[model samples]
Target: MIKLMRIDYRLIHGQVAMAWTSAIGANCLLVANDAVSKDSMRITTLKLARPAGCKLVIKSVEDSITALNSGVTDPYNLFIIVESVEDAYRLAKGYRNIRSINFGGAKPQKDCTRKLSVTTPVSERDMQLLKELVNEGIEIEIRQVPGDEKINVSKLL
Candidate 1:
């Protein structure tokens, strides 16, 4: 089953490898990013950063949705990570089982108009997508790591 959906620009990094795996009790980490899925070097680096016992699957957002919907990943407790709000919106629209999304580490974009958290910056487009997700009944929280206090994304906007 899908345990958590996280939005972290640097997916499967040190903080996530250490904290989120144990906290969510996830054995599988799915990175749903088109760019990373197509890049061999990024895939290799992500594999090296993954937790020792956890399995990592890097695929495009569409493929990830298909895998989850088709039960290809039903054997393990899955933690899904996406890089951007647009990707997260796509996942939320395509996957009905996702209950929550943690906004972890979005760097300030050149067009960012507001800072949601120290590491999370939002542009108008990002905020609009997030609001749409919220309206779809998906809970959104801003948290850097499992240890950090979760701030509701709605409150930031």
Candidate 2:
């Protein structure tokens, strides 16, 4: 079962490996990003970045959905990590009863607004899409780690 769902642009950075993992007490890390899933080098880098004794699985959003709903009944706490809000929106498409989503990081890019403390600018469309997602009952919050002061999407919007 997924203990936490994290949306971080830097999927396996130091903060993620050290702070978020420990904060959530996650034993297994599941990264759902198309680029990292397709690239062996990135996946290897992520694995190397993780602390010892942490089990990590890098898979696409589709594969993640399969694994998430497979009913395997994992005893270890699982963390689902994704890059963009769009990816989270995509991953949550068919899934049911998901409550909250965390905005970890979304580094700056041209024309992107600083939607959260850690994220850069996002498009108008993305903002709208995220609002719609929230309206559909998915809670969005901006926080670097579990213990960080969380910023609500409604207030931010």
Candidate 3:
């Protein structure tokens, strides 16, 4: 079962390794990103940052989708993390189980002119994709951490 899907540019870190994982009662952290899945250095870094007693699986977006669709992740309470809104969209579109997304953190893009939160910046392309996701009934929440109150992206957009 998927507890949450988050877009955090920094990926696994303090907040994610502790707060979000505990808050959602998730035992598995499934990182769905193309780049980091293939990077040895990043995989090592993420392994070091992983929460104690929690399982961490890093796979490319497509592979992640296959795992989710094939019921391989059903045994664990899964928390999916991606690096961008685009990647989140891809995962959500590919898998029917992802009904909500959390906007955790994003590095500023060259074309970004708006922010969904202090830690999350949004470009025009990002905004359009967000709108599309909202239209499809996917709930979008903006927050830096689980303790913060969720700000609805649909209302803001």
lDDT of each: 0.90, 0.78, 0.93
Sorted on TM-score, highest at the top, how do the candidates line up? 3, 1, 2
In candidate 3, what are the lDDT values of residues 28-133, reduced to their tens digit?
A: 9999999999999999999999999999999999999999999999999999999999999999899977889999988888899898777888999899999999
**lDDT (Cα, tens digit) per residue for candidate 2, span 3-75:** 7787788888888888888878888888998888999899889989976778988888888777777755267
Better model by TM-score: candidate 1 vs candidate 3: 3
Which numbered prediction scores highest in lDDT against the true structure?
3
For candidate 3, give the lDDT: 0.93
Index of the highest-TM-score prediction: 3
Candidate 3 lDDT trough over 10 residues, lowest sum:
112-121
* Residue 107 shift from truth in candidate 3, angstroms: 1.0
**Which pairs of residues clash in candidate 2, taking residues 3 or more apart in a chain or in different chains?**
112-121, 113-121, 113-122
- Report residue 54 deviation for candidate 2 (angstroms): 1.5
Between which residue pairs do clashes occur in model 3? none
Candidate 1 per-residue lDDT, tens place, 38-120, comes to 99999999999989989999999999989989989999899998999989999888888888999998966999998888888
